[model samples]
Target: MDSQRRQLHLFFLPYLAQGHMIPAIDMAKLFASKGLKISIVTTPLHASLLSKTIEKGKTLGFKLDVLIIEFPCVQVGLPNGFESYHMATSPDLRQKFLKATTILEHPLGELLQEHRPDCLVASVMFPWATVVARKFGIPRLIFHATSFFSICTSECLRLYEPHKNISSDSEPFIIPNFPNEIKLTRKQLPELFTQKVNDAGLMELYKQVIEAELTSYGAIFNSFYELEPAYADYYKRVLGRKAWHIGPVSLCNKENEDKARRGKEASIHGHECLKWLNSKEPNSVVYVCFGSMANFNDSQLMEIAMGLEASQQQFIWVVKREKNGGGKEEWLPEGFEKRVEGNGLIIRGWAPQVLILDHEAVGGFVTHCGWNSTLEGVAAGVPMVTWPVSAEQFYNEKLVTQVLRIGVGVGAQQWVRFLGDSIRREAIEKGLLRIMVGEEAEEMRSRARELGKMGNRAIEEGGSSYSDLNALIDNLRSHSFAVEE
Candidate 1:
């Protein structure tokens, strides 16, 4: 058989989080589009969220399959069917959810033995997969659902420990070994990096992941080199490893033929949001969403409502019911919806985020600076008003607002966990105004548009990301031949 015609199979194991799972799905589609057989190993509950994407891949004639393993919910003290971290009723249960996902290693190992894919790609959290891959002699690659910039910053911060001398996390510290002036307050760092809480379990998990990365064959990043060429190069040269920068994976949905065929049926909500956006003026509306897991208290919810109302800019806000402490209507200030009725459209459930951002009417984004959301905003060419809430989001905020220069910060310098510090309406209003109509908004918009164009081109035929993806495919294909021999 011709080398190009040789059969190849790849397995994807994503961390059981929406952010992680979604990008893994997108990566599978991109690979499958190139005629590689792809199977995603996930729980039944997580498989449901991916049904549409999987079906869409089938429609596009991409060889794709979903292998469901039992989710150890009850064992981990989680409610039945609560497989993903986001499915947990509250933020407090997140650790339990993480534990539950870890319990799947045994089951995942059995499945991998059955399928014995040519290569194994897994989320950062599933370091045990590296052991399985090694046992089976399969090439292992870890997928980080973030930008190259985030990886570089996180690694550098971990190595340098620049904040060690600081008495307070709130004190600003300049990060060492960077091409640009990158400064971050100790407070902005993630819990793991802060060195304040010594959770042995968490630290052990981090150690395992770092070891896995060092031992793995390579890494696959859900980011394009064009977006952060300097950092991508730094990651490769310093780490002394081959890292593939093939991303803005959300753009896989931009395949026009597949989109046209299944646009309405694939996502009714996306169509509805786009239709509504069509009525708004160009570059006039602000899009507000805090990602899948970020939650807020009543006061914070009300503050957000007040700020959106105060901004006077047209906006579409995706409000997940449970994420706002469950009582949605009660949380918003009285008469708030009535006042901003026409100017603001509040979506109570999942919003077609990529679709909304891609719309021409979206001018500004009020984001929590999640890596996926940040890249989507960049791909859409919309300037962001960054309000990083928790996790690695604070790190991502600096990448967007400071490194990229396409986003404006909302002064959220600290990681706000559940029931923590609240951002008042004044800060929200100022951030919105800065991104939407302030003197800097235009310049930011221009930069955002430029970045957006670069992101788009990077995924096109013969583009940087496109070439990288093809190279990865070819490398995998060659590996398949070697295995057969």
Candidate 2:
């Protein structure tokens, strides 16, 4: 017991985005609960965003600290509050945000040298953390907030370059060295791999991230073995590193019966949404949300709204208004709100997704297929209607619809900031119906429920993830002792 409290300390450097930061906070809380001292390093604003989670950790009797380093917003010529990736309004600004992360190297190095935590667990964004950790002889663990399948697929894409010989961006190509015959078009690949961007700095940062993963002591995945056992095994064989699968970390946020009894649902949106879900029958409502960063043009929003109306399923849709405010007044068709009032609820901004997904009424999800949203939906046992909008989301959609067999696709083949004729109301309605009420819906729902059960069991005592967490703790403890000696 005394040795369990070896005073081992771990510093976490998560990307300053809601999806990345939340999972990092949960991982920290998980470690702290097991007697390790944890500090999450972030900027002042990012720290504030996580204040509630940090406070909750304290309340639960854990030592979880938020160490704030100055963000180089002004130096980087970024607009005020545009410190993180998701805050960027344009692709140029997004590149600037990536550059700003590198500015933390000096301060982070100083902090690491001064505090000298046993290990530094950093998300792939701040690859420089690996250099700083090495300088201080700290074991660096890269936190990939993605699945083993994604990691493996991305790595294979890098090594094989199968897309290079394809005739066009839309041409289908199979990813080599993967556990399965996973095929993707060049358009579905991450932007970094597809072509050179205007921002040299961002491109260089991507290279650095890959290099950091190669050089780090090991990588930690926000996933569990059962979730992707083949990929988990394949990743180790290919990467030749000690990667640990100790997650579904978001499951740490699960509200117990006691909390539910006390009316504590993890509703970040209006309680009215959950209340609306409660009034509906079990496995009836189709919830639609395309993450924080996806911005749909007026045409796209109208098409979606019309599609939902056509589906005739009970629905809850969270709409993110366009950044330039171009489409707010004109986005939805006239009287569309009034028409679907009884069967649908449309939230304008952030919705408490976890709470909604875990609700009985939420039978189907129309998602952008971001990794965070995918994992959350999987954990909640909700099948998805994949409508990938941008970033690595298209690949994530493939993972869900094709690989996992737990989602149906809306056939959104490419990322778009504006609506094109590529996706219409009819196609959107077809996908929604397929996931919500079609022949495959029940089978998909069963697969999702099975995976959800496995995810829950993975985090339980004597489970694979539980053992991995303990193993990580013990490994860090031994490292701390050896360094002291």
Candidate 3:
């Protein structure tokens, strides 16, 4: 198949989180830009979101063709049709996801036979994807929703044996080959690691990476060379196949925006936030957001509020309003909200984060360092003030602060979680001050800018990331009837 005449099809299954959804959407748009046929598969709930987003895609050169599947989350004790970001309900999310996977094979098989897509790309979290692809004799690829570090840790754990000496709360032994030398606790890894999976009954999910690893044709990670070349190299060398890094997928947002200035499904609430951002000073505002999945307890929330108050910096904070999650002003020092009224924006619930980061007013981002937020921050050319909330975010912090020198994390020691411990007002204030004006801080800002440029260039018409993507397609077709355009 030649470039223009080539008709390529891809099946995308994300873990149903904001970080995963955004990148998948972006990839869809990128393929559209190249004049390829697009079909994105998802649960009915995500299908609604995608259907709405496809209207935005028309403005770019793409239109999303969705294959909606019934979600079996009800069987897993989860309510049906829950939104992508299920915060308070996340504990049951993995199980629901696992249940949903069992439903994928039959429905997905029918869709594939009818549509005949060129390939299937499933989220790393969705273990069943690779299996069905193998049984159907289709080329399969795993999309690394987290990072190379997450994959490394997971792979190493699969290689290790469970000693069976620990109780429910006892932490598993840390695996080797994790770079940057940080410690992980049972609390930090996914809940699956702690639980005894029920393979016979509950959701027959593939909890083992080894199982999916053997089933996949390749894996696609949404990262670039500059950010994680070392780990990327190790992943490819270890996995022994092409692990492609084609990213800054968020940049495709520009390609998807409408002339009316409406972003793809930009909510009335999120647009209002964007309007506020437009009113701020160039490179003077601090954009704060924790991707949809993370939620903070009240004490931690209060400490963070006080720190922002003490920093006396212009900032924004995104939080979910759980019935008990502290109030915006309640956490701050008395009258602090009144004092910083003009300088700060405390946006609870969802916001147009991509729009905010891309704004001229955003100079720095205070984040949980989720992969989506991290890549968006770097792609926007903004430096970071990392306060990692959970999971692989601690390792991501190391990439920013230690390896790449583009961000500063709060804790000096890699205390992944310090729930009983707190970073008070003075420490938060000092950290903010140093991030903005300190010489070493300035150096970080410079690196962030460079990384931002590289990120854009990589996805551009003739860039390294673009070439890598083409190469992957080329290789995948080497044995087949040529790759799709």
> For residues 241-303, could you state the per-residue lDDT of candidate 2 as single tens digits?
688888888787766321122112222344666678889999999989887677777778888
Q: Point out the higher-scoring one by lDDT: 2 or 3.
A: 2
Task: Estimate every model's Cα lDDT from 0 to 1.
Answer: 0.82, 0.81, 0.68
**Which ranking of candidates, highest TM-score first?**
1, 2, 3
Badly placed stretches (over 4 Å) of model 3 are 1-4, 59-63, 83-97, 157-207, 255-275, 322-329, 412-422, 477-479, 482-485
Clashes per model (N, Cα, C within 3 A): 0, 0, 0
Candidate order by lDDT, highest to lowest?
A: 1, 2, 3
Residue lDDT tens for model 3, 181-273 = 544555445434545434333323434455686657878878887678767877878756568888877776663142113223433365566
List per-candidate RMSD values in Å: 2.9, 3.2, 4.5
Candidate 2: stretches off by over 4 Å? 1-3, 256-270, 322-328, 416-422
